[model samples]
Target: MNKFGVSAQTLIAAAFGAAIMGSAFAVPKLLAPEAGAQPIAIQAPPGAPLSFADLIEKVEPAVVSVNVVSTQDLSELGDMDQFFEQFRGMPGLEDFFEQRREQQEQETPRTREARSLGSGFFISQDGLVVTNNHVVERATQIQIVMSDGREIDAELVGADPLTDLAVVRVKEPGPYPYVKFGSSKDIRKGDWVVALGNPFGLGGSASAGILSADGRELGAGSPYTDFLQIDAPINRGNSGGPTFDLKGNVIGVNSQILSPTGGSVGIGFAIPAELAKEVTDTLIQNGRVSRGWLGVQIGDLTPEFAEALGIEDVKGALIADVTTGSPAERAGLKRNDIILSVNGQKVTDSTSTTRLVAKLIANTKNKFDILRDGKPQSISVTVGERPADPNAISPVPGGANPAEPGAPSAVPGKMLPDFGVRLSPMDDATRIALGLRTGDTGLAITEVTKGGVFGEAGFEPGIIILDVNSRPVASVDAFERAIAEAKAANRSKVLLGLRVGQVTSYRTIDIPK
Candidate 1:
């Protein structure tokens, strides 16, 4: 009585059994028997069967309802209470304040009650659990409720927003059931899957679905999401729950969905279990994930740009800017270089490139294959640990200075046309006058037109350009060389490395060839 018709072997066995029993008790006790006139018992084949009940029972203990509560400060609550008290004289205001005061008093001890529900799966017996970062973000109190009516307080261990994964530790250590991560890469597109979570606070709920897609790009909003799409019924509260395969292995963590009504329309997204495993391991060890800094801004290679670069196919990402003194620069990456692969793995686009680099363990060495001037070249690069908030302003090599109003042109002999603005060589007197530091160098703007490209690019006449197309431009000839190379390669745009005040940064703009 399985879903399908009885197997041939089973039918043959039944025939044999019927032949041996004849007509006497063939129909009476064929499946089961006793002594004297006892019939033989039917035996099933030798392999283990796929049972959903067994898998669910085994993994249910690992899945938990994660509740987060945040509180407001006492002073803020008191201020609000007083403000409402002052409005008591107004009509209905007194009643409102009375009710508000009662509610405030009830919530006073806690100060605030910001409740959010998600799901998590235990990973270690000593109380380590994994869930989505959004689940417990900014939560002052986190509680994990087990299936057996047991609630344990959880503490934040670490989280990676890029991967949307987090690790938490329970207050009391105990032997806890845990689930293992499986190879999401081995899962086929139409594979059966299950999602376990507290959807809408409905605890320990399980929904069945099929794997709809993999390696899906959610968007650039999250630069690291290589989502696995499924038809599982996941919702807001399901954000951090485990998505399991038939074998009871965790394959993903439900993260997002594409729904117009905030309900499951058979479209849900999850962070793949592989990525989650890597992130959790790093966070557990270092308290934070350390990403590799490629020091390059990249964009998708266009068909025109691909043809210009003599590429048979437009499959690689185009390099827009290679930061000076960065790993990319030290590895000899340049603007207009097309990155095809990292460490021999193909990249689909710039986002994939970034994610792959970000996933690399910090301070690791890898090989990069890039296309330069239509020729493939491989370079060895040792990635550096990404600095926290790399955009923080620091002392630049030179100073930043804008010329005084009606000031005369300082370097008249060296000038270049930039978006109808004239840029001239930087001088020590101009730097001193504009409060520009000595470390700042390169061409400074001498003049600009109103509503010109220079203004659109946020450039004033006095700002200096340090590098063009990832090449240092100490003189006007170097600047021309960079521009000439870009034009010769038919690149649509080029990046300029500039120094302004204590800030050193880059900007990419179209090159009018």
Candidate 2:
């Protein structure tokens, strides 16, 4: 008001008038009581409970806090002499540096006891407790703290890292309060769930929220688990806890959460009870779970891949490379074959196929329906036990040595300006570098024009084009013939099988009209 050159008294009077008017209209509407209006009260929807206290009391006894003590190496801390070198020549600093050097020289390999906490629940009357594999991994000693403050020693019965589940047995046996796994399939999206655990080392904590979603895949770490997403506030110590349904049945096991602040953001994941129960049962019986192995590198059949392959539906797993001597190779499965179904179960994608195959019994004959060379065929093969370390099985034998000695340095090639790529005939040096076996024919990429179609498709020099539309291509003329045939058939896309590094994969490229 002062800067606008208006009188202070007048401005104050005007502001007072506006405030009076605003309050005159807003006060009655917001705060004034109406004669017949009952006091406003929020009510829960019909059938919803006002509180979860009853459910909490019934299931809290089964919940326990898992205390783990493990060893942590501190040997790296003994190398600090280099940091004090500049101060060595300073006045009156010689004694300090000498003492520090002596301490470092006297120090041996050091270690410390690291303590961590998680949660778990009893699953049987004979003291069979189920928790997460991570909770007890590398643990030198494990202690279970009960809800009533009773401490008991426990021994690891079995642990499955793939599913992040483990079973432990109490040293002193008794009829413990245990919970049973319920059917996660019956839980709807909006169904209520109660998570009981020890969050932040606070024992006997409980949280309730609706099931946010189901069948959420959280990347490669949990490839076999289709996690159930929940809005419950689960923190660090909540891992291995139980997520219970309204009927006090354990439906899921809290495993991970998505948060940037290291706290709950209402996005948490749980392993469904069905898978948990199955894995726990297997661990109890065999101390480990054995999965079926098919020995094939598979990928999802995307729309572009489907169109290039002349398939109508993109709902199967595409075989990229079949490992030599694997069950798949023994069964006559090959690269570029699309797996349609496994033992009458429709293959949806690579993940679904992986889960289905893992559920199969090892050494049992299983039927596989596949589309090979645009024709449907059936094959039977006995599933083999999956290797404990998945990386033990190489997709293909031999290593690439692109710069082999005594090889030709230059070779004649073809340049496709329209596609923005130069193709060269595969030489012995390139074959050895690509780890290709004998009789493998292909054209190698020599150069790619930046911002061109091939370059935009991620084609790089040294990549070997193995096949075009499932037809092996050895020369530029063969490639041209395959493209001409595709154009003649009115195909808009062509599938190219490529060998990059030591592995092989398929990519589809668009054809210009």
State each model's CA lDDT, in order. Answer: 0.77, 0.86
Q: Pick the candidate with the highest TM-score.
A: 2
lDDT of 1 by residue, 301-371 (tens): 75544543435665878775555567887778876678899999998788878888986866788988988
TM-score for each candidate, following the candidate numbering: 0.62, 0.84
Relative to the true structure, candidate 1 reaches a TM of: 0.62
- Candidate 1: stretches off by over 4 Å: 1-54, 71-113, 313-315, 330-332, 343-348, 375-380, 390-513
RMSD of each: 13.3, 7.8
Rate residue 501 of model 1 by lDDT: 50
Clashing pairs in 2: 400-433, 401-433, 402-433
Residue 425 lDDT (model 1): 69
Clashes of 2: 3
